[model samples]
Target: MYYAEGTHEPIIAPATFEQAKERLRKIAQQTANRKKPSRSAFSGLIRCGIICGDCGAFFGSKVWNSTSKYRRVIWRCNNKFKGEHKCETPHLYEETIKTRFVGAFNAILADKDSALENCRLMQSTLTDCSGLDAEIKSLLEEIDVVTELTKRCIAENSQTAQNQEEYAARYNGFVERYEKAKTRVEELHSIKNVRQAQADAIGAFMFEVQELDTLSEFDNKLWLTVIDTVTVHADGRMTFKFQGSTVIDA
Candidate 1:
């Protein structure tokens, strides 16, 4: 009979010290293999992009002096570092921007009416493009009619029912007009899509704003995640606009 550790069985037989040690070592190895490392709460929430409004440049961060007394995380403008014009704004301290962004985000999130108003403003701005879509559709219809006329003129010319030179000139004019209308239609369509995307982006940003708890909870990653560009005015006013807003200033 054998007695296991911590068991209430009768100790009719006992293992040698070496045998007990071997059993404990095997148990330890099994436990180690089954255990998993703990994950960080914010492991997946990191932003790697920063856009500048003044110089239209992007900045990235790098950690420096990992073991030094002054361990630093630095953000430098890629343009200035590449011998581009000295950007007027200094290399921003990551902590400063992080603090400001959190505050701004919190303000937006706290006020339900304001967030909805921002969404409405974006929708209104995009509504201006609605007429352009209608215009493009009408132009497409005109092009179709002109194209049919050109085809009819070609057939009439082949049958010799119409003067060849006169039919050819008319067809060339119709082709030219059709091409111009088609180009205009394409341009308007592109503009319409752009406006629609902007509207959608604004709607999405509003939703994100509604989810945030407080300004201080905003992380550096959240700034890059939510904002398109941040403009600092001459009057010390900072405006942060998302992709869809006409103007978002703080």
Candidate 2:
């Protein structure tokens, strides 16, 4: 095939295109070689993706028999009996977790439209950084002015015969103001980043929700994409934390 570049401009930048290709490659690998799910399914599924309500420890998976027909997967809190204060959280079977997920996920689907609306509103609110950007701009201007003033003060001090203490005081004052403005800019940036992350999560959740009205059976890829964590309590209470921080009890 001959090189056939599009007439229009490229849709994505080179770096972003490369990153997308890499991501797809990784996903392909994970799907192709699926086998015994890892015990520490941190970014995978409910093996270590669960949190214990009692001990606040992560859950780990175990196989009852390694080489037998009676092998069964069980999940329990890692610190269930580690210390004097033992965790009372009950061990859960893999099937139990899967069944619970189906129920909870179906519940979410029942309210899919309303949840999408709420998530859209939240994403809009969180992603709008106009106010913070304005403040950052103002602070940058102040920093620039202070920086120039400090330079002028130093220059004047060098050229003219000024009182040492007075000159030092003025120079330090400008420096302190500049530093304070810089620190405030950094703080604003930090806040913006955190909010933006939340917005992204909400957007992702909304997108996934929009794709399906109901799931006939559990799809591993979709489950991992939408679910963040599962928390189980001592009294057999379970909570599913979905992407975008949406929580549901099952």
Candidate 3:
């Protein structure tokens, strides 16, 4: 079942693998939580959550034979034939997507405890902002030092007949230092905020996983709570990415 055991060259380099992951990450961030009401359980998720693997486009929902004896609800790439090139990926029926999702859910449920533990560990790691906090604190202290120097420079210039040009230069240098330190502190705080948001998402996913029992059907509520995105490959394979960035290929 293993692809390789280091006895041969890797199918893909680590850098390439990371680049693909980064692209997927950006797409997931843009599409996750785009909840739109529709007839399908994964309606809103169809055009956003379920993505085309070959062309990197969202799958739009389509309903055929609406007024006939047989009706078909399918999802296909939104940009299938929009450009000069066309996507070779096939469309997925709602029933098929649901069935695959159920299998993926059960597979994860089979390792529920391990998954929950890993999520908790990840949440803990992301929530810990000690390093960023320390850096921010140091920058704030530097800003305070620079502020005091600026005040001293101004006071000395006013108290005695000092060269205005030299005094202005010193004051401007202090101001520049203070501004840089303040800007760095703001950037660090922004980074901490993003980490905390990720931690919160992991915590929410963990809570949902802890509450669920055996999953026999596709639960819309649970799916929304756990699924961040889904990728449908050209070969009819589907990969479900749950909250906390845990992925299950089915």
| Reference-based TM-score, model 2 | 0.73
Error of 1 at 34 (Å): 28
The predictions' CA RMSDs to the true structure, in order, are 23.3, 8.5, 14.2
lDDT of 1 by residue, 79-176 (tens): 65556566654555555556666666766666757667867876787857657857866886787788778877777778867776777789889888
lDDT of each: 0.60, 0.78, 0.78
Candidates ranked by lDDT: 3, 2, 1
Q: Best candidate per TM-score, number?
A: 2
**Per-model TM-score on C-alpha atoms:** 0.62, 0.73, 0.72
72 in model 3: Cα distance from truth in Å? 4.6
Q: Which stretches of candidate 3 lie over 4 Å from their true place?
A: 1-37, 63-73, 153-175
Please give, for residues 59-80, the per-residue lDDT of candidate 3 as tens digits.
9988899888787788999999
TM-score of 1: 0.62
Error of 1 at 21 (Å): 64
Report clashes for each candidate as comma-separated counts: 1, 0, 0
Per the 3 Å backbone cut-off, how many clashing residue pairs does candidate 3 have? 0
Candidate with top lDDT is 3
